[model samples]
Target: MENSVIKFHHCEKDIYCFFVPEQCPVCGESLSSRRLQEAPVSIPSPFVNGQKIKCSFLVKPTKGTFLREYDGRSDLHVGITNTKGVVYNYNETGVCRDEQGWAQSVSVPLVQPDMYSLINQWDPYLEQFSLAEMWNPQRYNETDHNCYTYALTFINCVLATQGKRNLTKTEFTEKFVLPRTKKASRYITLYQEISENYFYIVDSSQQEDDNSSI
Candidate 1:
């Protein structure tokens, strides 16, 4: 079955990668508008000094829009533009509305480390599958893996959400999956099991006592 969620991968430079199709592959009909079926939510990383990011969910294009348009399109035309212009194939400019309002413009961001890639939606199945391939440093390419593309996509989303209150674990799971859980777990297993490696809790009371002692 097709994904009910309109997938968006975060990237650097304030860009989100979304899938959009131009015409029906089966019937070849022009597709119409799309809408987010679920509210946008985010996962926060505790290690990164607190960061909140959005999730992926179902999208309902205006009635009459064919599902085929979104199926095989590589153009990234994912969301409806504020101008309401016709959503183009492979278009990244249109598909970003985080449950608040339509966004006007979009751009992709630059991510470093180049190892762990992230997706907005968490698929338990993907974890196992991706692990099978594992991240081969030699095989890394921006054009190849969906992991890189989506990680790049979400990096932009993270940059967009910076300066906001970090999301709680509940918020993170409800919204997006923690990036690089599988591989990182091998290195940081202790951190993952306890807090999902999302946040670092600070004891304010202890800090005050320590200050008094000093």
Candidate 2:
């Protein structure tokens, strides 16, 4: 596949594409791209590992040819891929109807930790969902399904409040270091200093003269 030229289908949506490697392209973090493809049902990396942002929404089949069927199961699975390249999966059950189509839905979630802060900025009382269903199994049986109605939108908002979004090492230290030092105060003396280009921490064992900038 590496040697083969890749093609993308034109999407009206502004899509961000990434070329994932054997390891995290950023932060030099070790990753297993191979494992994802090899799994019986491939679970994307961001979902299983460190910090990921996610959101889910439902989709109803309104027009023609909006539904699909699988060979073995009476149910269907709703899945989505986020900007960070993680995939979220939900299993749904549905039944076919005589008319007005089947009431089916898909929950679409995105993995964007920064979005939580932005969402709160928009609405303080917005409902937060913990787990979401992406597909309906009732309408997924033998016949064609259409005109689905999605119930909710769930997003993982915890990551944002926990300060897991985009951050530099310096910024992270400034935001989280003080509290850590305070909590460890009983065990050791933690002195800290920050300058325009230097930041350092001193232990109780360090002599005053030994404490100096890098």
Candidate 3:
């Protein structure tokens, strides 16, 4: 999914990243047209003391627009991005890189910026783990040992290198992965309802705005 939050100046600029919301969330200014960002690519980092850091990310296609172009099992092909954003994934063709298409991704930023050596070694470690014998193409299973398996295992390897606890399938899914998918699902549902009815007002008397996000 695209970024839903942004910084806005009272005076607009020249380029926009996503859909122009009716009003600016920051200044409460009405946006008739050209709700642009002056520095669209200069988004400030929220991690590592506001410095841009290379992070490992989990990626999956969010939803198809008109034509549903995706995997054969009607399931998404999951991939892990290296420090350079090169997507590595397993398929019938075995461990590969840069093959998976664009996806909605969530970054795994457990590694701190201070661990420079470990951060620098992410790519090689990931490459070594991905090439292991268990990830052979003939061993691939659409249901059982598949791309998701490769992603989790590789992540655990990286964690082990950093002397951290390996996340169980339950922990990884519940803690990191599912939360994002579920929240995105909620926003999509909300957007659809608003499109159909022009509004989706919540019961403010009973329940406050759902301020929490994944």
Candidate 4:
């Protein structure tokens, strides 16, 4: 069965508060309260000097219009973030680095602190893989051995080091990749839905705060 997306309402400062049908999850109260329960402790690390350190796997819609012609459909790009918050994604050009964005992401809890090292080690290999693909179109099929596969390979390698069984391509796509991509797509749709409605006005006062964080 397909996974269902979690429903939430935008709260103060754009924080998402989970909802259960007509009721709020926190306070066991009505949704009108708008007060959130203490934010769940983050998975990566607790706030250090008021800064949250996070390492995650992100599934972002491909940027720009140029590459869309290749697949004739919107494609998802998968990447992993380092503890330093840098994102590493494999693309036609090779592995690219960028700062984290407000995209769909899943926290990847490190079994050991050294797992971060394992992620970094894949960078060179991914670059090599991409280079080989550039020389041969058949090396990486757009639908099969693409960015999603690249990210999955890296994730499976990390899991293997932790004595966990590696995930098959089908298992990885069905269990992790597809679910996260669907959630991200739904989030974009929900945001547009809310934006078109007149009742859910965002406070202009928080614009600066939001931009700064981004």
Q: Which pairs in model 3 have colliding backbones?
A: none
Worst 10 residues of 3 by lDDT: 44-53
lDDT of 1 by residue, 1-214 (tens): 1122122111111111123335422234554444322322232221210012122221222222222222222333222111112211111221222333212112111223331333322233223323333233344443653333333333344445444454443554344433332222222232332233232222345535665211
Cα-based lDDT for every prediction: 0.28, 0.28, 0.57, 0.47
Model 4 C-alpha RMSD vs. true structure (Å) is 11.9
Best by TM-score: 3
User: Candidate 4, residues 73-141: lDDT per residue as tens digits?
Assistant: 565566665556567666665566666442334334433566656556555644454454442434556
Clashes of 4: 0
Error of 4 at 191 (Å): 2.0
- Can you write out model 3's per-residue Cα lDDT over 108-196, one digit (the tens) per residue? 55467688887788888888888789999999988889888888887788778668889988998888877655665554544444445
* Candidate 1 CA-lDDT value: 0.28
Off by over 4 Å in 2: 1-3, 6-77, 80-86, 92-214
| Candidates 1 and 4 compared by lDDT, better number | 4
Residue lDDT tens for model 2, 1-214: 0111111111111111222344432234453534332321221211121113223322322232122331222333232223332333332333221222223332234334566555443222222121322235543333333211222121324345555564443553355433432332321111111111121223323423554211
C-alpha RMSD by candidate, in order: 23.2, 22.9, 8.1, 11.9
In model 4, the runs with Cα more than 4 Å from the true position are 1-54, 64-73, 100-140, 199-214
